[model samples]
Each structure stands twice: as structure tokens, then as C-alpha cells.
Target: MNNSLLIKYGLAGVGLDIVSSADICKHVFHTKASTKRMHTKNDNNNTEYSAVQSEPWSCTERCFPKLICCTYIHKTIANAFHPFIFIPGDGGSQVEAKINKTNSVHYICAKTSTDFFNIWLNLELLVPVVIDCWIDNIKLRYDNVTRRTSNTEGVETRIPGFGSTEPVEWLDPSHASTGAYFTDIGRLLYFTDIVNALVKLGHVRNQTLKGAPFDFRKAPNENQDYFVKLKQLVEETYESNGKTSVILLAHSMGGPMSQYFLNLQKQNWKDKYIKCLVTLSGAWGGSVKAVKVFAIGDDLGSYMLNGKVMKLEQITNPSLAWLMPSRNYWKMDEVLVQTDTKNYTLSNIEDYFMDVEYPNGWEMYQDTLPHSLNLTAPGVEVHCIYGTNVSTVEQVFYKAGSFYENPTLINGDGDGTVNRRSLEGCKTWSSKQKQKVYDLALPKVDHMGILKNVNVLEYISNLVNGL
Candidate 1:
């Protein structure tokens, strides 16, 4: 084991600098260890570790480096994503990974993800870990929303993780985005841009008639794909290094993805190499926006075009008066906005306004796991980080009953996409919840901002260490 590395992401500090350990092969991963909850009153302050019960994967002799990077949009921190980070290598934006040395941007997590774990080994740091660098895009890009639009000229496209005022940069785009190139520096801005975009939606979408930006709930299957790829990347890392396990740290939506991935591993990955998983502000249950939109919004559920699910209109019926926020509507002749740049000059809300339908895909998900709290289930030692900053985004985007009805007319808390309570879950605490943080659920923070905040690391370190 190594002296604990303190990761200072927000404050003035670089990532972990390791005194390289020896590369060890042929080790047994203990599956009997069980982790404790967040350092709160419920658990009475206890810290012990355990692994899952399954057939373990053996290491092939090789010096491999495990490097996996995720883009929620094009940025590092997302409101709904875990704040896993890395140092930009000489190549700038290209995702890079190494086996022996760690390249980090945050202090605590600066060490390789494997270093974050409390594994008992002599030489090199070898354990299972996951790094989630996905940034949340306020205007979500998913199945329900189309990435581009067909206009009078041709098809107008909405760039991923950008604003009308900035440059349009595209990624491999597992979610959305096409055409041109998205730079490495541009990707770093993914989380921040997403937070700002979603926050501004209350004004752009509701106040103006032209409607706001795009919003997608993200499909469970797509999320599953990203994790699978990440697992492969990490394995490649292990093969590049001698062999190591890692502690997984995922935030917000990543939490649910982590859950889904672990479930897959438990079922088919008994021989898969995964160390541990951690999550922050994940929506294990369906989001409140989904329920509210279906319950409150107009027959907006009818707007599910193609394979797309409607925005937040999650529910079926709603009372109109409650859904309407205020009578003060912004008086504007044409709600449409044309940017200074020719690239982004279209709006999805208007083009697809009349064409809408309910999402039957969501229906199947809801029916099966109305609130599957499996992420923190016992077989695996999962950690959770919850947020308290729902009020700000809520007040801006959603009113009291907005989720149920007139989402177009009212706005509420959350980062404009998910509600606070929904992310926290209906139940406050559970015996199964471990390595948790209720304090990060602050009043000032929004969904995306939490991803970049510096103070989050203290609790994260505690949770990781405790786990």
C-alpha cells in the first residue's frame, strides 16, 4: 500500500505523484468484503471493505496501461455525471492512458484510479478502478431528440456541448452531434457549457415562444454501451501494465450506468475484472421530469416522435392550473433565434412542435424497475454521492406542478433536466447505501456545477478511503 494521496481538484493542487510500485501478477481478488455507508449517523461510523461473489478473471502476462475517458457532452464535469478527471497529455485533447505513471488534473484522483483503492500489495498499484470524465449537456442529446434538423436550406444541426455564442465542436458522438471537428480544449468545456445551457432554458424555452434547446433523458441501453467500452479500455490498461484492479467513481447518471454495468458483470462478468464502483446523484428511479411531463404537460407525451421520448413530460395526466407558473409571458413576435454563426440557426422545439408522441420505451423501463435501487445493492460494494442544489435549478426551470402539466409554461429546480428529489430518491437513507455524502447536496449548486466544485473531493476521498 502507498501513503494516502490527497486529491485537491477545486483548490490549488495537482494530481497524485506516485513512487511507482512493483507489478504483481497472479493475485486473488477477495469477494467477501462489504463496504459501509457515507460517514453519517446511520452506520455509526464504520469502515470495512469487501468484493463481489463471482468467478474472477485471470491476468495475462503483460505491462498494460488502463486509460478510459468518457464525454457526457464534450467536457470534464457534468451536473449529472461523476467528476472523474485526468491530466491533459502533450497531445492536448486526444484521450491518452499509461500503465506505470499517472497523468492527473485533480489532487485526490490524480493518482491512477487504481491508487484510490486501499489494496494490500507490495510494489505497483494494481486494483480495479473506473474513471468517468463525462460532462452533462443541459440540452441533452439522446434518442428522443434528433441531433440535426432539415430547414429551408437543408438540414440544420445542433452541435454537441456548445452555445450559439461559441464555436461548434463535435465528438465521436455516441449521444448526438455530427459534422466538423470538436477540439480537445473544447471538450474540457463540456460540463460547464451543459450546466449553463440547461440553466438558461427556463428563460429560452419557457419565456420565449420559439422554445429552448434540446433535452434528452438518455437511454439505459446507450449508457450501458459506454460502460462496456470503458470496461474494455480498462482491461487494455491492465494488459498494458502488469495487472491491476480499480475503484470505480461515477457521478449522477453514471451511477445508474455503473449499476447497470455491475448487474451485467454479476450475471455474465463473473470472470470480468472490476474492482469497485462509486456513484453521485444517480437516478436509479426514473426522473421526476418524466413523471411530471406525463402527469402535467399537455398531450405532450403524444410528441414522442420516431424513437424519441418526449422531454420531461413523464406522466400521463395533469391539472392545468397547477402546471402554469405565472401569467407574465415574455412578449415577443418571433420566438425563433438565429445565431451570428451560420452553423446553429435552427430550433427543434418549433420544427418538431406539432409532431409528438409518448415514449413506450420509458413505459417498459418504469414497469420493470419503478425504482430499482440496485446500484447500492449488497453483492457489490457501491458508494453514493447525493446533491442538495436542486432548489436553484428548480426555481429557474420548474414551478411546483410543472412536471405534471405545461412544462413549456413553467420551470423548476434541478439543472433544468432532473429534479433534486428525484435524484436523491424517494427514500432518504437506506441500510444498503454506503460511502455516501449528503452535504454535497448544497443549495447553491446545480446539476452541472457540482461536477466542477473543489469541495466535493474531501467527501469523495473520505468515501473512497472508507470504502
Candidate 2:
């Protein structure tokens, strides 16, 4: 192989060069096994070898020309995504496997037929009626306190969990669907762009772009069946690619779920299965906004489509309750953000939701979260990326004790939904374990926007390539 290779050596004579064993290993194990974390200390006690290195492949010229150019690039590009798994944010994945009006349970209820008719009329007919009313020069009075006017013209309709305005044409082949709008576009919107970007960088193969979809409506541990499926996917990917450790990229609530799943595994699973975790706007401590939703159900969102108003009403979800700021994490002085002059903690507001009727008792559900310690896997290296620009309400209040009363909102810097303090929870480690935590704060980016942020994507690509 060496004799056939072109050589440019000083003309002392035709000389032979020997390639080191490490060089061969570097090319052969272009997978993460070569980049596995290793630590060594010098006499000066300067510890070395971080979890992430410069790049997984170092193109050195110590080998044959054919081996250097063809073999390395081909193997590295083909096996890139075998070591990566993407975890999506809340409502990031398609929740409904199949939608049948006859078999599906009704999520809405009314006291009387007349009430139902009126509700449907208001929701379905009001938008076009209002538009017509405006065009016909009819004066309509709506109290801003109770009701407000909305005009949706030239605005693209948005589906829940889907970031695109375009209609969905494709659906996941694994699941059959009956709903007209139930398409795979919602699921694709979550991580497909990031996956595609990685694919362009030659760090992710199209076929290996796998999604670990779960019921975000339920708590992480509560959905053991889905976690089992996630585990299977991880194992399959690992075994398929020569036991390469996987790099988990999770966003929003997916981050906590990934943490819970990782915590369930044996301590040594990190060494064998996981390379490191990269979280984007992770709800580590939970969000104060969720508390407001429970205390006073929100309007959710509304849209006008086909001369109809589609309004989504807020409802209590157990998984959302799970995302509520935990006591341990909320009470941390470093992360306890202040709104106006008063400092708000989960303890100060737990009473508001205590009396609120949840599907199950609030106390029973409260028992699910850790009481003393924050929910995080031990010894796993976590790199946190979050947005901090919009003014997030740190606490909600009313003139009286009820949400119906004149309400007031206090705001601070955050990702519009989650505060910077909460997103940075992973960085609040003890001094001994501080080395395991890393973080980056992006300004003026919202929670949902972080998924599409170029900087965030670039950072993730670097992490994947470096790992």
C-alpha cells in the first residue's frame, strides 16, 4: 500500500515511514470510542482530558493516500448519527397515534345541548361573523376586560407542535391515522431541521435520524413503557454501530425526561452508553408560568381558518404539573429570581394550586417530584443552552385571592416561558462536580425559538462532531 502511494520526501533517498498504532486506531475507531473521555494529571496537578475534545476525527497525513482520503471520510460520515439521539420539547412529538371521532373519548363537555350549540357557534362562526360585521360597518361593543377583538388576515395558521405554516402532507408510516390534519409534520417540525443540518455536516445519516416520542402529558417516570422504547432505541443504535456512546440532545421538557431516563440506568451506563447530554431550554427546575395555568386556566391560543375561529382552552395536564418548579430547585438562592421587589418561590405559591381541583388530588401528584434533592443523574456531563431575553412573569397575583380578580404580572429576564435561572439549573453543581457542568446563554431568544436558533444549532453540531 505504501509503495503505490505518492510521496514528497527530501531526496536523500527513497525512505520508508512507519505509521503509529494510535494513528491506525484514530482512523479505524472514527466512532466515539476513540473520543471517549480520559483524564490524566501532570506533576503540577493540572488535570487534562475533558469529556468533549476538539473533533472526533483528526485528518493526519501519517497514513497511505488512499486510506487517508477515502476510508476515513466514508466511515465517519456513514456512522455519524449512530451515536446521537434527539429528545424534543413539550408537545414536540405527535401525541395521537390515531384519531377516530367515534372511538376517541370527547375532551370537551357541556351542561346542556343549548350550551354546546352556543359554544360551537361562538368558536366556529364568530370569526367570519366579526369580519363580516366589520365589512358591513356594524359597530360591535366588546369589553377589553372580558372580551377582545382579533383580526387574522394574511397570517398563516399554525398547528400545535408544528412550527411550520405549511399544510402537512406526510405522516409517520409506523402509525395509521384518520384525522384530516393529523400528519407527521408536527413531529417533523421538532427536530428535523436540526437533524437535517447535522446530515449536511456529515455527522448524521438520514436513516439514523431517530425520534424518541413520548406522552408529554404524563410524567417521565409514569410512562415507563415509552422509556423502555427509548432504551431499546439507544441500545439498538449503540449495538448497530460498534458500541459507540450516544450524545443526547434534548429540548425543553424532553431534557428533564432524558435526565429521569438516564437516572434510572445504572451509574456505569454513562461510560458504556452515553457520551454527554446537550440540553436546550431545559425545564430543570420547572416554570412559574405553569403555576399560573393551573391557578387560572389560560386562553391557550386562537386562530381563524376557513371562516371559523379555532380556540384552544387551557386544561390541567399532569405532565405540566410535573414541570412546575420543584421545591429544592425553586428554593435555590442562586436561581430564585425576583419579580418587582418581592422574591417568589414555589413554597409561597403552592397553596394556590393546593385547593385547585386537579384530575387527581394535587397532594398525590406533588408526591411524584423529589422532595429534598433536584432530579438529575449523577456523574453525567451536561451542557446547557438556553435563551434569555423576553420578560417572563416570575409570579402571578390578583387584587383579591382569586384569578377572576384583577390580576397583576411581575416579569424578569427569561426565554419568554422559562427563566434563565431555571434553564441554568444544571450548572448549579457542587464545587467538586462543577467540572461536569457547562452552559451558554443566548439573548433575546424565546423557548420555542431556541429550537430554530442558528447559534444553538451550531453549538450542538460542534458538540456532536467533537464528541
Name the best candidate (by lDDT): 2
How much RMSD separates candidate 2 from the native structure?
15.3
Candidate 1, 303-355: lDDT as tens digits: 21211222232222111111111111111231222222211111232221222
Which lDDT value does model 1 have at 309?
A: 28
Question: Would you list the C-alpha lDDT of every candidate in the order shown?
Answer: 0.30, 0.52
Clashing pairs in model 2, backbone N/Cα/C closer than 3 A: none
- After the best TM-score superposition of candidate 2, give how far the Cα of residue 17 lies from its true spot, in angstroms: 37
* Local error of candidate 1 at residue 461 (angstroms): 4.9
What is residue 389's positional error in candidate 2, in angstroms? 2.7
Task: Give the C-alpha lDDT of model 1.
Answer: 0.30
